[model samples]
Target chain A: MSDSTLTVERVSLRIGTFALQDISFSLAPGQVYGILGPSGAGKSVLLETIAGFYWPDHGRILIEGRDVTRAAPEARRVGFMFQDYALFPHLTVAQNVKFGLQFRRSRPRPTEHSQVQDLLARLGLEQIAERHPSNLSGGEKQRVALARALAMEPAFFLFDEPLSALDARTRDSLREELRTLLRELGVPAIYVTHDQTEALVLADRLAVIRDGVLLQEGTPSEVFGAPVDEFVARFVGVETIIAGRVLCTHDGVATVQVTPERRIEAVDHGAVRSPSVLVCIRPEDVALNRPPAKDSAGANQFPGRVVGGEPLGPMLKVKLDCGFPLTAFVTKRTYLDLKLAPGAEVVAHIEAAAVHLIGQP
Target chain B: MRTQTLGQSRGLVFVFSVVGGLLLAFILVPLLRMYATQTPATLMQIAAIEDVQSAIWLSLEAAFLTALLAGALGVPLAYLLARTTFPGKGVVEAVVDLPLAIPHTVVGIALLFVFGRTGIIGGPVNAVTGFQFWGTWGGIVIAMLFVSVTYTVNAARVGFESVDARLERVARTLGAGPWSVFGRVTLPLAWRGIVTGLMLTYARSISEFGAVIILTYYPMTAPVKIYDLFLQSGLDESSAMAVLFLTASLAVFIILRHLSYGRVTPGGRRM
Candidate 1:
């Protein structure tokens, strides 16, 4: 259990036109790594390959440093929770949890009852333990499936869009619960999902996959802030990428100056080497000021004119016609207070920490 | 346009009624003949006979055995064919279903060749087990199994196919092996279909006359006994046997329908 580290080394599987080509990732013990991609992105295929459902056409999958590329799903001891929560229609909740226990019947363990109860209780599924999956809601069914998978106490876990079937509210809550469970279990979990928010919320590290290839893998903050490519940058919901250059470096921070006027600041360590660098920032993080505030808390102000403001419920998303045309989100009250309108002069004050220093694109 | 549509609808109803009534009569006539009798007590008296009793018992035994045989063998093959990618799957399916297209007499002849006293494996098999198949109950069972079990096998195959293979695979990853997963997940989901198949197999075997007569005429099952009564006794005796069999068959049909359609499964019921 301690040495369970699942690694997929350049595994390539071809199924007709769809394929996972040169896909590689390693799940360290207790870390939840999300494989995020669009539909038809081979995310599910990669998960299935790891679960030993699909034998990859090339490369190998090593579970605990043991090559299990050809092993049967049961032999691999890799628990796969399907998107549909494929709970047994016949077995009661208790029986479903006990199903895997029966497989290891030859050498019966004493911890079966307590472990099963503990898991059911942990999932808040104790009352439903005697009930069947058909009786449960989508979220309940998912928890039962999770409990069932965890009951076996497999080497690692594979979740194929566990939250995709749930409602938005249920998804958010379940994500937190799943995160807690995975941490408690201390087994690496590979979560496959197409939902960007689900990946961001669930995974300690998110890997963006598209058409079977691993585009990028890093912590949520790292991947979201400094995406390696434009495709990944948009995937992480960072729409605005301004081409800026390192003007100067003071106190381990690079002063990146973009456009004719706006000066953006970002942390500059070893990689902020050249004058030419791309400054990345999220639209929501950008601030639109009424009059140019020269000095603000960690905020570098820029001169710009309001091109348009789109009222989205309580918030107003104003588009600034700066050099890069920044989008800033502000409250409707603030928008009204400032009397912001199209062709009006505004200040774009971006926090130094908010400005991301990405690789030159 | 509305009045014309209504007029066309009325005409459609008239045409549909004429066709539907004819179709209903086509199915209902034979059923009416089987149940309609000179008197209610007559069928009861006919069924009271020792030979009639034996024929009914034999029919039950043979059909039950055939169903059991089909279930035991059909499930594994169904799962294998449903879950795996293998060479010659269509060929295997065709071969399994060959009995449905083949004449029952041919099936009898085939069984005779395989299980007869002077047959290929039959001679050695008879020497070892001291069992005779040409006229014994075993021959009846084999012949019944041959035709009856195919319906069960194919239907069960369809049932097994209806279950998503991913469910079983997920169960396997949940620590269920091939056997446990099939038992816990696949079997329950597919049970209703398999049960329907088993019922069909039972009904078919019990009613099967051609193969049973050709294979084992001595141990006359219900259908065979009915045929014999028609030949030896008269139309009256045959009618009585028919009435009795109709009752038994109807009861079985009702039981099967009840078992299959009575309620949602416990899992579904909870929802």
Candidate 2:
């Protein structure tokens, strides 16, 4: 895209036993691309590569259509915010924000002071400007770090687990504020985190990585609704992942036999001919009812015993065993009205469109 | 149970007091006795003496020079040691600490072997400079540095290690070159540890006697002067010199310690 602010082209890096193999992504202006993965997924390494801390072994990085793969981080015009905030413990909040400005090649504009002041005020960090980083709360430290990074007014931003170091409550609140901040800045940003919800909420697009390889990349809804593989499906909150045999493909729909008596019909997305495949169903997509009427017979409906039910805030997550286990989350009010319990019999309905088949790796 | 813990703690306190107290007294007694032996009148008289004053001045100058040199050479080495993993890193670390483990006298002898006249680089160095490390202020500084630079290196290593590398990366991305990152972010953050290291180096360098004596006794440091005075004229005169030197060094050291470690103002700008 002409408006792409950052493009990482086939970037690969080898560090000891681990390697990031051919990671390629592009982010347009006003886009937040979240890299979601487990801890050792090389997410931070990719972010650092973009930030010019680590040079990739075999790839190019272009910022605003200019090749800067070999450029120094300072010359690349990138801003990075670390997980720990890295607020320069020796500097006050105001001074930390001013640190980058002093090193910038451009002469100070008349609005420099007020620009910094405006950032601090916008982040609600004005009161703590004179205080050192050690004195600020986790949320405050995050805001100050954001303000500092923004003072540089770089081409793009890279964040490494930005909200992970905060407590859950603080993370929840800061997540929204950060999303808003990123939106308001309207700059392409790469947000790296292991949390799916964080990625889903903050990123305009999501990349799922595992073991240093880019597994899948798509919009939040696309990745969550239909992950490309089992790893991605499980990582993106699809609670039920079933290894099944492709019994047959009929009229562009594949019948995946999860068990002898349990078969699922799914529209084949071109890999159904594989001997083995994984049928992934999101818990939110599975509809559960106390019982099905006689006229409600469907090829994808099955009788199941409720093996477990747990309340998750306003949702009740129910586990079912219909030859194979399936999980479904129902509204708490509906769950309560249904009188669902561990030993109760229920009908599980799965629309063929909602059943995604990924070739077993 | 409460009484048992209290009694046990009391017994531990007694034991600790006895052992710690003996060691404390052992250190404090000689210095206190040296100070007590000199009246403010005798101290003033000693201070007024040209040799004593010169020796004191030389010691301070040599120590300051030693610290500055050590910091310049050792800080980069410390940063390298702290950050990078090389083949012989452990050995390098151990070698840096070799001075601390070896006897001060042996350190002097080792310095003599390498930097002394008629020795390895010493002969060539002597010919080139028309002077030898022996009987020179350079020798005194080298001697002091040989024994004390480790403290600076180690302290600076710890300081550099404590400064998170992530911050450096962030600085780089924020448009700071490597040198700028080091100067603005790494150095400022690690300043306290480096300052402490320099202070230790200064204190160690100023007090060094054996090495300085072995290497260059002519331009006497305070300790060497005190030793020479003790040999030529017994206790009273030497004690007066010791008292004067101790008070002056201690006062200066205390003031420096206070300035460095004491109330570091906000933003730590003073540090």
Candidate 3:
């Protein structure tokens, strides 16, 4: 019987200097839950404690209601894939995949052959099955590690930064592949990573951990689109969350007045029409135009002067003081065409659909 | 590949060869004298002595057993020293390798004092056990263990340290318990280096003279037998025993070293 639910309840473990304080979260079966945090955020420690490595200083871990806090890692029946993929160097891909299954004290031994073949094919490692880890590429090693973990038919999957060690290109592709693989197999998994983009793309729900404390956990939209606090809000993105009042509503869309006397409209939530409401928006949602000809149609416009602008890769993130100083994202090409400089008068036009009214105030 | 640098390289090579040749001369000349008196028939005849044969076998057994003890005790200590960081880690590490610098005779005397009848820890231990370690196979084992502990401890420590801790963490998350992870991932990877260390320790123990001489001069090992034969019989008998012991110990050492480095086929053929 496969357990689809992994519950970590108040698991507090202090490893060295980092202390995980009463961390708790539950993941539904077949969903990839990512533990996301900055470096030294106790993210890896949390994953390890749940996997039964570091004995929790307090609390219990329940896999579908059974307390496994004191259980051995192998006895816990969880599969852990590491950032380096940690393929056994001496073993071929086939042998590596068969490692966990071979240890089962069962009636019939799981043959090294078929289990290897099935998982290798599943992970597209069939052709490379006979090769050692040192011979495989990064993506290939990642797959081999995944294959090895999955071959055991584990109760839950634990991914400790599976894509963190890969080159950028491989990480991008493998993230999608890993998410798809977990989904297709319907294996409940807990993934830990510092890479926010990977968490955003791969996790069904994101648990934001910082300094060993779980700051928040929700669906990607819930965690990212509707973060809980100031740090989470900034970590999700460097944009601002504004508390404002719904000045008016037309055809179910309400305009909220923001700080620095700017009005923004979002697909209205009934609660948002109250005296105060909070709207979450990313810098990418705002576009800068030269004073949008006094009044723009089908757009929420606010006049602001560019205070700062920086080009980072394909996008230009500009700081604007449209009332409240805020950042707006545009293409580098767009920045150049608009000649967006500091103190430049620009109209910040926001798409109504992009203004995310997160939660009740 | 410039002419000036090539000339410098050649000059350096000449100097290195000269120094190496002198050192080889210093080592090989004395060894050649030890074997120079032997003829084939005399070698065969003297080597056929049963007492000398038994002593050599005893020495080999003692060395092998001692190496096994070192491997069992030293690997875990090495692992702890390598993977963990705690207060006085450096002090602990230095203490583990301290035997290497200490004279083996001092070790034998220390073992004797500790395990000797009226000695500090030895008195209680001997009284409790009623079994003697003095002049016994047990004493030989203790002597060899003391002398060779650094071999297994240092090499296996480096081996364990070479492994990424992240891998163990991964194994843990993979549902492998601490013990299983150690047995599966940690032990297997470090086995090669540990085997090499064990073989080297065995070689050193087998060839040891000073410690064995100090502790148990009886139930004579080959080195002891050779020394006794030199005093009692003469050079011919002593040289024969020496050659025999040397050949056997060297052969086993080479075989162990080869086994450590080379792959063995399932059918027992070393590749």
Best by TM-score: 2
Over A1-361, each residue of candidate 2 has an lDDT whose tens digit, in order, gives 3558988899999988989999988998888999999999999888888877778999999999999998888888787878877888778899888877877667566767887899889888888898888788877887888788888888888889988877888899889888887887787788999999899999999999998899888899888888987778889989999999988888878898899898999988775557698889989988877776334657788888989999886688999998999999999777777777888888888888899888865
DockQ, per-model, please?
0.49, 0.58, 0.34
Candidate 1 lDDT over B1-271, as tens digits, reads: 3434534687777788799999999999977976675476777788789999899888887788888898898878877777777999999988888878878888888888888878787778899988888778888988888887778877887888888777788777866677777777788788777887888888888888888788889888988999899999988888888878767777877876686766456356721
lDDT of 3 by residue, B9-84 (tens): 8777778879999999999887788878778887788778888888999999999999999999999998998888
Candidate 1 structure quality by residue, lDDT tens digits, A1-361? 3254888889999999988889877888878888888888998888888887889999988999888889988888777888768887777888777667656755457777887888889888988888877778876887788788777778888888877877778878878877877787687888988887778877888899998889998898888877877788878877577788787888877887786676777876556656777777787787776775656444467777888888765678888877667888888877887778898887787767777776663
Runs in model 1 lying further than 4 Å from the true structure: A1-4, A55-71, A75-77, A105-111, A183-188, A242-279, A291-320, A323-325, A335-347, A351-361, B1-22, B109-130, B256-271
Give per-residue CA lDDT, model 3, range A36-134, as digits (tens). Answer: 888889887787787777789999888877888998777777787777777777677787888777666662664657767888898898898777777
Q: Tens digits of per-residue lDDT for model 2 on B162-263?
A: 888888888887778889888887887777778889999999999998888887878888999999888998788889998888878888888888887664
Global lDDT of each model? 0.80, 0.86, 0.79
Order of the predicted models by DockQ, top scorer first? 2, 1, 3
iRMSD for each candidate structure, in the order shown? 2.1, 2.5, 5.4
Candidate 3 or 1, higher lDDT = 1
